[model samples]
Target: MIRPNMERPTMKRREFLATTTALGALTLVTPGRLLAETPVAGGTLVWGHSETTQNLDMHQTGTASTSRVLQNIHNALVTVNSDMEVVPQLAESYEVSDDGLEYTFRLRAGVMFHDGSTLTSEDVKYSFERCADPETGATNFEVFNDVAGIETPDELTVIVRMTRPNAPFLARLAENGAGVVMPAGSGDIQGTTPVGAGPFRFIRREFGNEVVLERFDDYWDGPAHLERIIAREITEPTVRLTGLRTGELHMINDIPAERVAEVEGDASLQVLTWFPLNFDFLNFNHDLELFQDARVRRAFDLMIDKEMLLQGALWGQGETTASASFPNDAARNTDITQRGQDIAAARALLSEAGHPPGSLNVVFKVTTNYPYHVESAQIIAEWAREAGVNMTIEQLTWADWLSQVWVDRDFQMTMMNFFTIWEPDRLYFSLWHSTGGFNYRNINVPEIDALAEEARGTIDADARNALYRRIQDMVSEEALDVILWFRNGSIGARSEVAGLDTLVHPNGSNLNFHKVWLRS
Candidate 1:
């Protein structure tokens, strides 16, 4: 469903404009009238950027946090609405051929890039082609793998021919990587400069300090309300909280789990929450010798207490999950709530797998920086010990965790979280596809992969949902990955801020910034 954070009520458009205008007139008539009378249009919003993003190239990085910043300064051919449906953005509209292999998009007329260059179908063709190239190192290349070729008949029309029918093709176009569209003759703008048709224009970036964006008055969607937005990098939760408390920051993200109560109690601060499609779970590396046995995987799954983890570790902020896919997804199987903490069942399964008590050496990998990861790892390790399984915990930083542990599959199992979207097709296909880059070599049943292909090719919603349900059940029964919990997405904003809608989607990028304005 379309779950948006509604805790902060929205003001009527007429009332908001009246208040802003009155305040603007009053402030402008003061001693510093020049600054105040300037339409209340220009003000910098200081936002916290939690992590250090190495690359600003949207195609190179599919992480949500990075995408959130990129979307303001870049534009996609199409945009995903709050309901997870595709809406026209750069392309005014599109039509699918009867066979569903060809898609023709009509580009909006008179759209200009931030650099004053007119947008053309050639740029669209070049951008998609570049993203599909293997040398680009784009994490989202697989999304467009179905495209056999792209053709631009004229300046305003672009046609894409797919090798196979892809039902989720339009949704994929709304992804973050899809927003990185550039001019045709830009000549490798990835590492150097980024030009796009977006509401905001990039001015300057100070690494580790802040990123400044100025309003694009010539934006195709009409001028944005805010004049400038400054996204600052503040990794520490306490520092971010302090900034919000002292009025130094307009907005902050990734609120500390412990401070949820305090933030909610404050009258001057507003806490926005949404049920995101993100799922945190334990991923087993089947390539590892110890994790190869299905029985062993099942035994490990039974050894952990998910409910207790949600209560004690996550502080009830997360919901228990049975299916590897998101619970809210139409594809999820609600019937199977697999293996709770049953030490006897776990021990028997271990015996059946020929792994005697204390014989199995299982290493749990987690990032040292994430508090929830540390808590969950400690609890699971203890539970596994109780079930007579020898377990050890290994912690690493974010960079080391991704490169050495995650990429290499160096550990027996690792605690990882996926920031999924509302659609199950994207989540299921990405995590379970045999050739999926992020699958991390954990394909157990080829049948499930075949089912995924079948679902992708099917256009009917009911048929596709049925295929997804079967895949979910098959994966859960086989114990491919131990489903843990679904965490809520949250954002903290000052009381003066209005129209702050946040959702649980990755990066909280689905926010509607167009209607937001400062309260008088």
Candidate 2:
């Protein structure tokens, strides 16, 4: 049995100190700028971000773009605060039994949904059951599968019995997709027309254009200070910057690092930067015969230079690591051998694997949604070619890529930026665990699967960290995926926009519209 590493009790919190410290320094508004401005209760806040698929059903489609909109339109049972602590949202309070198997939640009284339906324990049961159901196709089905049974003793109380102890259950509840709570039996919620009990109410949506939300006066916490919130789909970063300059958009996400100084120089705009809990990587389709050999994967990893990729493609906006685990965690074992650009060694490995000089062809897939992806792909292809690997680049639209690569899983390799949950253990489960919904790589190492299962049940943080360390070492040695870099995120917003930058969570629910108000 694994033992908890109690020597560093507060290590997890301190692991994020550097990143959080930088965020504190970067998110400051122009001095004395907003001091005289009082938050007013009326104007509509118009925000813009990159466009992705829209499945209005928050539970069904867990895309980051859709979750940003849903964060306001619906409230989860729990939420991570600005400090990154998981706290109850819809649930007034909760309790767990000694065995860590049974959890009871008390629903907050008098909370109202958009349709005037009162929040009740039944709604909680229905929402969770639906997520656990295979037919619902909930993105978080695997996460919610621990629910052995749920019992509603009364209108205001819900008791959940887990099949096994799950340390990250509450943290999972705070995630973007799993946190959302819809009315019981609200059949097939659409993105265009949503019925949520959040501070914002769904008004309308024009696909490829914008999604509009209005304030819900009956919100349990309090009605949103703004009368309305509009999330406009702006695909081009330059156009978004122009929108910010012309005052067409009040806030925008993902301003390229090259433009950071320009946005910060403008007195009317403030740049909010933070080291987001996300990383870009190249995922290998292990089912492909070419990648079936671990030796070939290691060869592919050694040929690429992560530093060049970050500098040339990302404009030095991120940090690189060899570990599959989140680098911010202290539990991440840094003792593992680091792989760097070694063309000769890579070529030797490839040759030893029976593939010599241009004998193998590999397709590299990427989407044009983020310019960095295409740039990185080009650089990676060049590096691979140096080792005599004939790499071909394939560009697809975001939607098309999602269908073919994510859903159909018919590709050799693809590049993507994925987010990590606040619950560190869930990150491992989501990527390495066999049942992990996002484990598109189809990695099925028996030892890794056993560790993932053990990690979930191990409540002691230290022991969990130990298991994760071993897991990371295994993944790194096998070169399961190439973890390129950890990204730095920024939101470009008008000086008048207040509270928009206060809620930055790793799960991509950065926009907290309820707390945002226009300064007068």
Candidate 3:
């Protein structure tokens, strides 16, 4: 991870206020002018996002860009702090039953939706039920599948009973799909019109160009400092960096690794780095005969040099992955180190698996959005060829690749990344479960299914952690997936920007906008 020297001098409050006041007067001031005039109250913050969200339905969409947008317009029952701790949002306090099957939440009083409707337990119930509905197209239905029922004793109290003990229930509530809470009886109007109690209220969206959000005056926490926010979709990485440098954008997400040095060297911009709880890995088609053999999978893992990929292709922006997921994860197995590059061992293993020459026809498919993905695929293909494996590379548009290569399972292997949060139950269970939607036809392991089930059924943190370690070890030894690397988080902001906190979970839903203010 890139570490910035924290001891470097920062502008003091008095200097910041004076500068902001001058800038605010020179520039057109709006509702959030306090962020400019007072240097703390508020100002509009323009953010350039790298990708456009496919859908606005928070429950249905799984992309991080969409989640960031949703987080601004919708507030969950709970929120995750910068320190990766779960905190109360709409709910003031919560209590868990001794058996760990029931959760009771007391709502914060006087919270109201943008429509001037007061929040109640009924809204919370409808929100969860809508999320649990299959027809709702909620991408994270698996997280709430164990819910037996939801009960509201009063307007401010919500009780939830689960079919089994779940230790990560609160963490799941802070996740992408579960973070959005809609008004009661508003199920039919979700995608068309969404109303929530977040700092910003949705105005309108123009596909592929921008999404407009206006600050809510009656926000429970306090009035947002920013009068307005415009999320622009700028797909090019270089264009994003240039925009930040030129002051065309207040902030830009997902800065390119190659331009990090250049951007940091510029006096007009400041670069922030955070270690995200996310990783990318290679998924093998286990149903395919060639990949069904554990020996063949192990041979493929030994062929690629992870360190070279991280340093050369990734530009030293990532950590070599030992398992299919992040090592810092609570469920990760610390005992197993990643297999180093050993071409000889790979060749021998391939021969033992009946591929005498260690060469087999393989295809690598990747999406075009993340240029590094295609680059990584090419590097891996070259390494495989050197290790006596015949490989073909194919690049496809994001939509086509998702539908054909990934969902359709038409390729021998594919490169994909999971933007994970703090909860491994959802991360591991969704990726490795026998019936997991993201399993992508590679769910043939009964042992993994059992382990994941056991982990989900336990409420104790230590027991659940032990279960995760076992799962990691099992997948690593079996070569279920060839883990590549865990990516680092990078963002470019103008020098005048402040309060931009570090991101612990790199799921793209950054939450510091509420505290961020512009220095005049």
Ranking of candidates on TM-score, top first: 2, 3, 1
Q: What lDDT does model 3 reach?
A: 0.73
- Top candidate on TM-score is 2
Tens digits of per-residue lDDT for model 3, 1-520:
1111111111122332243221211111122223433436667788888777666777876666677787777888986654445668898887777677888888999898987889999999999998888888677777787899999999999999989776677777876778567888776766756678888898988877888888888999987767778888887788887787788899887788777667767666766654442478877888899899989889888988888988776787767767654334445677887788998899889988888664488888887767788888888888888778888888876667767765578878888877744467766777788766567747577888888888777756677778878877877888888777777666777866666642223333354465566775
> What are the TM-scores, per candidate, against the unseen true structure?
0.85, 0.93, 0.86
Question: What's the lDDT for candidate 1?
Answer: 0.70
Query: Model-by-model lDDT, in order?
Result: 0.70, 0.77, 0.73
Give the clashing pairs for model 2: 5-462, 56-191
Error (Å) of candidate 2 at residue 120 is 0.6
Once superposed on the true structure, which residue ranges of model 1 sit more than 4 Å away at CA? 1-40, 185-187, 191-193, 203-210, 324-328, 502-515
After superposition, candidate 2 runs with Cα above 4 Å error: 1-15, 18-26, 29-37, 190-192, 506-509
Give model 1's TM-score versus the native structure. 0.85
320-401, model 2: which lDDT tens digit per residue? 7676454556567787755888999999999999999889899988988777898888998998889999999999877777
lDDT of 1 by residue, 24-124 (tens): 11010011112222223556677776654446776776456556666776788876654445667898887777677888888999998888999999989
- Leading candidate by lDDT: 2
Please state the error at residue 499 of candidate 2 in Å: 2.3
